[model samples]
Target: MDERFTIRAMKKEDIEEVYEIEKMSFTAPWSKESLYYELEQNLFAKYLVVEYEGSVIGYCGLWVIMDDAQITNIAVHPDFRGRKIGEALLRFSMQLCKEMSAKRLSLEVRVSNHIAQSLYRKLGFETGGIRKNYYTDNYEDAKVMWVNLG
Candidate 1:
């Protein structure tokens, strides 16, 4: 939890490290192709990586469309969890969303992920709705959350 840890826009070279963290952090993680598509094709997508001491420990992606920003994904390495890295990443993403003139930010979290729910709530996000059987790997429901920025 060093205060010197930095977050910056993700580079193509950082995808491997990001991918590793994605795999480690989620049970049904995004495929490499899906991530590459976001990096190479999504024009409105902004991806970021968190680095501490030159090592990538976490990543987040946002897709901005009009006045809304959709959080595509966020993950932190297991070893780096509980150190506030996720909170830092979320705050950074919120700032980026505001800079983009987004009126709101939205994301979906597994309903069972209480830890993430609490973190998002602390950041001013509220549960908006639920998507039934949203997670493909295990058919878990997703709790859609949103934060009003305006």
Candidate 2:
């Protein structure tokens, strides 16, 4: 398979596909209604989707406020995981934040998600702290990670 992945700003119509990937990738997925709200109502949010052959295969959610930015969520379809799509999405998101003049970018990962944590560290993120019981589904502590964009 020729994996020609393209990343672009997500549109309202991409919600259903994005929601599917979201549900498959996370233990507690965001509701489609919440995605609608993110696209239609959230002022601090920006979303980007990765398209492969006209299908939405992955997505990233970003929230920028002042000079700080947060990765609200990010995921790639299981069928597309080994291609480093998630890393690409994170790189793109970091560039977007830099373009927006954000001095720092941060996100939380489940402590058990070492693959993701490895990717974050490769992108220069460092562990900042731990959030207790961050994942409601399993009550797993979240490892807070951050990187300096400046």
Candidate 3:
């Protein structure tokens, strides 16, 4: 971990950096408009960004619904991969979910993303189900994963 890096709640000013990371991390990244809407209008949405010496390097978003927290997205900058930033982001999100009184945390990852699936498994996420053709851009299947906090 870089001593200069810190994790904190995402701000409206971080949209550009977040967008850049999203573009680098995912084939079909969320639009800036969607990110803006989450920051401005979504009460259930909670986002966190990792800043390395004041620059946003990674970000993750979660949506709290009832007693569950759904991990909407998570991405690390291409330059910062293999540095454990993603794990830190996931840990922070899990802590936030617990603090928000969520009994479980859930997310959907592309079936082809074995690396992410391995990471989630190491973090205690278990496969719940599969969504056929969940990702439209490439028609990739999605594997649903869940972690019980209770």
Query: What would the TM-scores of all predictions be?
Result: 0.97, 0.97, 0.98
> Of models 1 and 3, which has the larger TM-score?
3
Can you write out model 3's per-residue Cα lDDT over 59-135, one digit (the tens) per residue?
A: 99999988999999999998999989999889989999999999999999999899999999999999999999999
> Candidate 3, after superposition: displacement of residue 28 in Å?
1.2
Kindly list the per-residue Cα lDDT of model 2 for residues 66-125, writing each as its tens digit. Answer: 999999999999999988888889999999999999999999999999999999999999
How many residue pairs clash per model?
0, 0, 0
Stretches > 4 Å off in candidate 2:
1-3
- The collision pairs in model 1 are none
Candidate 3 TM-score over all chains jointly? 0.98
**Stretches of candidate 3 above 4 Å error?**
none
Q: CA lDDT of each candidate?
A: 0.93, 0.94, 0.94
lDDT (tens digit, per residue) of candidate 1 on 41-125: 9999999999988999999999999899999999899988999999999999999999999999999999999999999999999
At residue 60, what lDDT does model 2 achieve?
Answer: 95
Worst 10 residues of 1 by lDDT: 1-10
Question: Cα lDDT of model 2 overall?
Answer: 0.94
